[model samples]
Target chain A: MENRVLEEWEIKEMLSRYGIRVPRGIVVESLPEKLELEFPVVLKVSDPRIIHKSDVGGVILNIKNYPDLKEKFMEMKRRFPDSKFLIESMERQGVEVIIGVIKDRTFGEAIMFGLGGIFTELYRDVSFRLIPIDEYDAREMIDEIKARKIFEGFRNIKANKDSVVDLLLKVSRLVTDMGGKIDQLDLNPVIVREDGAVVVDAKMVIIP
Target chain B: MFEHLLNPRSIAVIGASSDERKIGNVIVKNLIYFGYGGRIYPVNPKNEIIYGHKTYPSLDSIEDEIDISIITLPATMVPDAVESCVKKNVKYVIAIAGGFSETGERGAELERMILDKIRGTNTRVIGPNTVGIYVPRSNVSTALTLPERTALPGDGSIAFISQSGALGLLTMDTIAEFGTGISAFINLGNRIDLSENELIKYFEDDEKTRSIVLYIENFKNGRDFFNVAKETVMKKPIVVLKSGRTSEGARAASLHTGALASNDAVTDGALAQAGIIRAYSETELMDYGKVLAYQKPLYGDRIAIVTTAGGLGVITADYLVSTEKGVGMKLAVISDENKKRIRDTIVPFGSAENPIDLTADGSTEQYSRVLEILNSERNVDGIIVYALFQTAKVDETLIDVLEDNMKGKPMVVGILGSKMGKRMILEAEKRGIPAFPSMERTVKAIKVLYMRGRYLKRRYEDGEQGS
Candidate 1:
């Protein structure tokens, strides 16, 4: 029954350990140590205290070059004096699906799958299954969503449905492996690319 | 756990009275009027006889192996009555008083007093503030409602258990109107013992029950309840109507599970895991119960709609496809060969596709013949027939056609008209077709049938039930 939020880097580390794809990233309090090679990178204010970084303009995406990235990083540092920033290279376009695990008191941990991004709030199309579900159950969760048609390359938008299914199975296995140490996990907007699914924005509330 | 409580052969009404206004009087009178063949003992210290039957001044006066005793005394007198019933070696007891834990701390302490008295004895109590059990099979009727307002249901396979007393009676009353019999009904108010888990397990082997319906507000131990539900569903369907889903009730949750996940959503997951069909209203509860009890569970999603009205066929089709707000069911695509059979049977003007309309001039023969074809079709798993009686072509004889036909492949019949429609639907339901007058409701009934069908198929798929 963990109830405390974990840092974004810690969440990514756990996801990577479970073979869930995530952007290669690092955390830093200052701009000096090392620079990323990707041209268009994403810089996120990764303070555990800042649950909603976008709300505070802590997220500066598409920092096209090194100079602009440095200025934007310096500006974010000035606003949040003691905050740690996370930097990762931006990925390509893909479909967004949210995978969540909440430790329900009555039914224990239940896995949730639904359309992610802004459309998630508008449609609220989600389905739930209790944890320790098999790969077949994971596929059912993907098929349960009515908007699943989009996964079949709707309007020339390529998305490998099998990739999403694999992501669900891996996340389920990850949550089950953590047992009671993890209270709730939210991988909102887990982008489904042609080859595999990537955890775009991850948050975990650990059992305290 | 609940056999002795649900099917007690003999019962005694403590605080029995001859007066009409008293509940003691009502219990005794209902016992006799409801045709409970079991021996009835009226324990009244002030009277020697009640309604021409022998009455005793105390439990010690006269008794011959009491199986159940009803305590109708005040809250303060409950402990003494329970002690006396225990002394008489009663196996089950029903406390019909209200001033218990639901009242205040003092009342709670008094209710605890009764619980303390029954500790070492074999006597199990249903409630300190409840309506008790009603089983037509054993001739046990303890619902607070009088016979005049609603008669006890005949013997049937559907059993209902609820936590609300008055609501249980009202639910039973509503179910009785549908012509379905009651195998057992329990109003588990202020559950001291005999929770839903134990009762569900009790029905798992009971030969009389084919389906179980529950009206639950909360679970004493949710994990235990789900465990029992998982086992029970492999045998029969469980229909649940969960009340108090509003955020007001949800806000009082103390645990993180209650706070993080909505009660409604968590309950939905539980229901899905247990293969329970959740009912949105009282109507759907009985509606689903009727279908589950009468028709064979559906084996697939394909359904064919046969109706006299094209608009009704369209309405049912829209409802079937509107899965977001409703259960998504596929309309059966009739093959060209079968389509030709339908086309040849109906009038030339009538459409003979999936809907299989026989026009307003359609005869009862067309309706009957099309059902035979659909029944023999391998693609068709279930059907929804919109038999609107307003059309001159359809008549009461159509009921006979539907009744004799519809050979165990799931079917839902809907009729929308005045008295004729009402009479036809009721009559059709009496024959076990799960008929309704509204197209939306008919579609819902079809959904439940299909749900049960799919469940049964999966349940028996491997030919080996692990449990």
Candidate 2:
């Protein structure tokens, strides 16, 4: 709401509004005497202008206890004095997939799906569909990608296909609800476990 | 509105000449040789007669209303010719000149002048920098190529549109050679008056066009064209082979979404959204046209390949099953009942599997019998019949049985190699079955049929079909 580029928390809030589930996160403006939460949490810097969080030493993962959390938190605070930070529970390891939306000038709203996270950058394996996609189109898009094999599970994991389909349909609906204000949206590293999937990270760019 | 362009009743050849080497001479000669069933008025200031037709000094000299005026003159004189056409109430103008837009500033200025002249008038121009159109049914061809170079089209269901004139005609030659006919061919060089959007509507309105294929470099108005394509695809499949797919943005892109989704990715997505099938090559475009023009869109991906040879069927099975999961089609599991029928009908040693091999000993009776059993099986979405005429037992009779059996079902045919094979393939095509010389091409056509079916299913589910 304050800037053209929405930060991670803002994008997550937007996703929550569209019925897309994101990992539980809390933005801490001030450090308390004691942090009350489970271990194995992720802390990421919240900044609308910074596009890549990990590249800038802004993302800290796997702090097992309060001492480690506070130590990493203070280190990050010392590194960037003015930036806000968000701490959330780290999601269980699952198949990571990328779901995105790009407003094509020819066709109005186009959605993209593929294997997500760093490998998405390395391999560039992606598939696309126009918005207002139905359950059938969602299923087809899920099946169309080369990385579709990831959804079938690997190494003692079961396929979480229904969750992937639900996510795609929600993304499709989100594109429609954005009403053309949404220029692009990326939910990279969406953890898909056997039970369900969650948006581990999200970034959206409006008309800027 | 483009009906006159496709079915011009009378034409005036503006630079008609008697010299053999001149473009005007070749156009006039080509028109006469093709048996164009229309009145031709040859206009030339220098000649009193051209090819035995009485030549007038100008178009206004003709009393009849001119439907089209073919101008083969210098770029500077094109505007004046259009002025003449406007006065004559010419419905279409094919400017067979090359110096507009392609030759830079001065030529672009001349093109602008022609555009200025034809504004708010009935005169619609095809090109100022290119060749024109080809309509097989009407025998109306405005391309400058003579009889020796390009074979004229036979009447068929494909309506082809191309941005490049020469490429369009050469594609025409290739497709015509492949035993498919074109309903209409439009060369849209320097599309001054008409672009693809309006022509798309024109092709959609024409009941004769069952499928439309396009060769595009870039669109004049991409969104506008896509909107029209969305409307047309449910009724008739539009296959496009788009050029100019360079990874120009990959270097500047900052995110995986941006880098992975190239211009072509966006284009392909747009095309898919519109339900228009995109072909990667001209041959695939033609092959898609052949199947689309003849058969109905398949309802499923379960294909039943019936072949005389085992190797062809094996190869086809590989391609169909080798694709990614969603679009990957399977060889329909031939029911035991149908297998028994094949055994009862064909030789006992002949296989009764999905690729029901009639063996090298297959004859017309066996082909028809296997086709009947397959046709009766509801599990079979489409069939690919391979007729090897070289087997010494098969003859021209196979074509008759094939045309009869394949009438209502979606299908393609593959014949053996050689002159005999080409003849049989063309023979089957003449009777309205898409026949090819190789299994690869035939299976590819079948794959297109399956893709069309999937698209139709998606369209119906989306309810855009009613729109």
Alpha-carbon error at B338 in model 1, in Å?
Answer: 2.7
lDDT score, candidate 1, position A172: 78
Q: Which ten residues in a row have the lowest lDDT in candidate 2 chain A?
A: A150-159
Which one is best on TM-score? 2
TM-score of chain A of 2: 0.92
DockQ of each: 0.29, 0.43
How high is the CA lDDT of each candidate model? Answer: 0.80, 0.82
Best by DockQ: 2
Off by over 4 Å in 2: A1-3, A34-37, A105-108, B103-106, B249-254, B324-327, B464-467
Error of 1 at A87 (Å): 3.0
Q: In candidate 1, how many clashes are counted?
A: 6
CAPRI verdict (incorrect, acceptable, medium, high) for model 1:
acceptable
Give the C-alpha interface root-mean-square deviation per candidate: 4.4, 2.3
Per-residue C-alpha lDDT of model 2 across residues B1-467, encoded as one tens digit per residue: 77777888998999888888888888888788888989999899875777888888998889899888999887888999999999888898899898888889999999889989989887789887768888988898888776776775688989999999878888888877756888899888998878888888888879889899999887877778777898888788899999877744333334457667777877876787678888888888888887888888888888898888888877778877776422368888988888888899877777888778888888888888889889888889889888888787888998999889766578888886888888887888788888887777788888888888888887786676546
